[model samples]
Target: MDMKKMAGDKAAEYVKDGMVVGLGTGSTAYHMVNAIGERVKNGLKIQAIPTSKATEAQARELGIPLLTIDEVDHVDLDIDGVDEIDPQFNAIKGGGGALYREKVVATLAKEVIWIMDESKLVDHIGAFHLPVEIAQYGSKQAMARMEECGWKPVLRVRDGKTFVTDNGNYIADLHLGAGFDIEDVREKLGTIVGVLEHGLFLNMCKRMIVGTSSEGVRVIENPSK
Candidate 1:
């Protein structure tokens, strides 16, 4: 089986009937949503909460049941994609501005299972431009502070204008040098006044389904102890 499809298939097994689940964003998550739709057609009876408007549209087209965050006490599972993931299960996400919702859904779920391809797995996560969503006002101040913290911050603009998130925020691409201290940088950036949320997801995932080009799909779960 193709690795990406295999990863999707593996992720689908974690979704059970009658569960309120978080539907993730990005290509891998797109595949997962399709697999879930198939199961739903077969009477999975799951309630899906999409992390982005794009995802919500897709889910609706597939006839997957939808729910709001306040409608459920907690979600049974959350399966999403990451830009890059380190051995510690720390990840950089939200390249598509779905980070805030994704984080909310993941934290609200009993289990978070991040699915990704082998190319996305990394020994370190900072090399890829880290996405930082922030309030519109005081953005320049935030950018300068990030530079002082050793990140080269660039405002992400689209078609000659600032790229706006689904929630109407801006994304600053923070370019950190290779092998930077992932945990320390995450903490320091998180403290900045204008910072809304950074791409770094630390110790938030309970499990991961990693797809490899040759190895098929492999599952890594946090120790039960």
Candidate 2:
């Protein structure tokens, strides 16, 4: 089986009936949504809260029952994708511009599981440009502040226009120089104004299922667990 698909299938095994699940967005996460759809069709009962409008529409098309976060106090589990996962299990996500919503959903979940192909694993992060969601009004100020912090902040444009996220914010893709501590980086970025959210996720992933062609699959648990 394709490694990404295999990883999603394996993660789907953790989904059970009568639970609230947080659905993620991305190619890898799309596979998981399909797997959950098949289970729902087979009479499995679950309510899903999608982190992005794209994911919400896709899940509805697949007939997976959906609910908004306002309706649920907590999510039983959250399965999402990551752009880069470091050795410490800290991750950078939001390549799809869903980081703000993804973070909200993830932090609310009792457990968060990241599913990915082995290619996303890294020794240290900052390879893929980090995504930072900033309010449009003062976005220029935010980018300048980010540059002051030693990052190359580039405004993301899609189809010749500013890339607007589902939340209607602009994106600043930060090319952070490699080899920095994830927590330190997050703390530094958190101090900037107009910075609504960033892709750096720290100490939030409870489990990670990595799919490999030769190994089939590997499930790594959080060391603190």
Candidate 3:
């Protein structure tokens, strides 16, 4: 079975009528958006904010009502995917280069849900390189600063060119190894002048749904929620 599809489709069921939804980016999120689109075709009434241009286009093609962030007072629920997630519900995102916008949407969301396959679960979050979005201006200096802190920053490149995010920023993936101090690294990254946002999503998830081979789809409510 397609675990990503299982998790994503399960999360889409949470969207109720007359709610403002935050549609996320990436492969797993693609399934959620597709499921939500089907509901829309069946008369689900909801306005949606897409986290990336790709998501926006998909939602538009599916006739999902699109609304800018400015048009909505707040997002009722934001369903997204994570690269890696710890037992504590902390996660690493931005593998899709949508971290900046994803964070923005999550910040304004009253509730957040992350859907993922079982493989994404981990004892710690550092296995997946954390992505930090930075401005192009002085990016080299910023990366040098990150190196000085031993975060092992690497500029993201795609198709033989620097990968630019939809927000027109560069992503620096940090190889922080396992068991690194999340707070300390977050603080240090924040001090970098060119840094705009990092992939560390701490305390923002309200629930997590995982698709497992054995159990099928499992839902874990955030204890802190």
Q: Pick the candidate with the highest TM-score.
A: 3
Candidate 2 residue-wise lDDT, 76-137, digit = tens? 99999999998788899999899999999999999999999999999888889999999999
Inter-residue clash pairs, candidate 3: none
Rank order (by lDDT, best first): 3, 2, 1
Model 2 lDDT on a 0 to 1 scale: 0.92
- What's the CA error at residue 105 for candidate 2, in Å? 0.5
Q: Residue-wise lDDT of candidate 3 within 19-117, one digit each (tens)?
A: 999999999999999999999999999999999999999999999999998887799999999999999999999999999999999999999999999
TM-scores for every predicted model: 0.94, 0.97, 0.99
* TM-score rank order: 3, 2, 1
Cα lDDT of model 1 by residue, 98-213, tens digit: 88888889889888888888888889887788899988899889988988987889999888999988888889998885578877888898789999988878878888898887
Model 3: runs farther than 4 Å from truth? none
**Least well predicted 10-residue stretch by lDDT in candidate 1:** 1-10
Q: Candidate 1: which stretches are off by over 4 Å?
A: none
The 0-to-1 C-alpha lDDT of every candidate, in the order given, reads 0.87, 0.92, 0.96
Q: Give candidate 2's TM-score.
A: 0.97
